[model samples]
Target: MAAVETMVRVGKAAHGRGVFAKRAIRKGTLVGLVQGKVIDDAEYYSDYCIDLGGTLSLEPKTPFCYLNHCCEPNCQLLLTEKRNKDGSLAPSTVHVKTLRGIKLGEELTIDYAWDSVKPLRCLCGAASCRGWIVAVNHVFDKSTAY
Candidate 1:
């Protein structure tokens, strides 16, 4: 398949830098791969790192690293398994795909599914805003926005 154009750009966001769609993107389209070096879980914190299941993380090297978290995200991360040169099966690829049709200039976001290690105060402003972003299973009092 021909590469999809670089359909996103970096821009200001409520919290800080964020990724924005440069043009309308259809639902279920593959946004792109998360390019980066894999690191052990003990590295310094960076907003660009993604948890690659226990004890491992991906430090993104591309603009896609700027994607922010949203309670109601328009994109989702999917993992694909591949055979390494050594002939071992491993989950070696992560892809970002659109969850719904997005308008030009709209922010591209993903549900971080963040765990409680370092919860963040969410300001996504979505109607279903979870108040605080924590681990997927961690429950918090939602009476007040965190």
Candidate 2:
């Protein structure tokens, strides 16, 4: 069997560690898979937890965890569910896909849209920067956009 080529690499970013494109990637490409330990506690919290539907969350590993946020992002996360023959639930998965073409060496980013307890200041530097790492729905005022 032929080996699959890697599409991303980890490197330093303005926001600390970040994922970068190893090659020029086209729009809608599957860039990476978010694999992690599944935490069943709905009340569990972490800086790295990713919602996996229902009462589950993912503590993503390595490359996936290093992906940072951008107000105007070039990537997006997609969650998919699986089921058994009996129609019961199975393990879910999250995929990182490109929303637009990504150039080699360009840092891959997603809209975190976090509704964090203590809202984090954003340094994504996108022209349309929301100024905070928060969900748009949580932004109530122009002055305090979180």
Candidate 3:
């Protein structure tokens, strides 16, 4: 394992074992890439998996993938749609680094509202932390948007 990965480990924090930022990460920097093989959403749903990005690989796992869900996230893992050479859709991810610095013990979190599912409650205890990580539209549905 790389020294970076060694700095991080998946363990229970608030909800369950979560990946934490071992070092201070700069905004817009590449935290890491999801090199795991792609799995269909169906497979993703069936597995009840904890890994993010709906893919799995044996490469050195980083704390970035273990980040829990938050209504308001410090950093964002954006999923972009790319057209394959065959004109098919391929989803890729890019990390939107946090505007501010995060301590080593802070949990790396992001809102998981891409689909129609409601956001999960957060336990990170940040003053602005929303109880749930809901869809942006739904977040506006309630009075949590600040």
Query: Best candidate per TM-score, number?
Result: 2
Clashing pairs for predicted structure model 2, backbone only = none
Residues 1-146 of candidate 1 have per-residue lDDT tens digits of 22434688888988888889888889998888888887765654666677765456778865777889999999998877667689865446888899999999999999987655556788889998876776567775555433
How would you encode candidate 2's per-residue C-alpha lDDT over 21-92 as one tens digit per residue? 888898998887788899988799898788887788899988889989999999999889977799977668
Residues 1-146, candidate 3, lDDT per residue (tens digit)? 13546344566766666767777766655555544445555444421223234343122234555666665566665545556699865555444356456667666666655433433455657676646555545533344332
Q: Which ten residues in a row have the lowest lDDT in candidate 3?
A: 51-60
**Candidate that beats the other on TM-score, 2 or 3, i.e. the better one:** 2
Tell me, by lDDT, which candidate is best.
2
All candidates: CA RMSD in angstroms? 3.3, 2.9, 6.0
Instruction: lDDT for model 1, please.
Output: 0.78
Report lDDT per candidate: 0.78, 0.84, 0.52
Name the runs in model 3 displaced over 4 angstroms.
1-8, 41-65, 94-96, 114-119, 139-146
Least lDDT summed over 10 consecutive residues: which range in candidate 2? 1-10
Q: Between 1 and 2, whose TM-score is larger?
A: 2
As a whole number from 0 to 100, the lDDT of residue 142 in candidate 1 is: 58
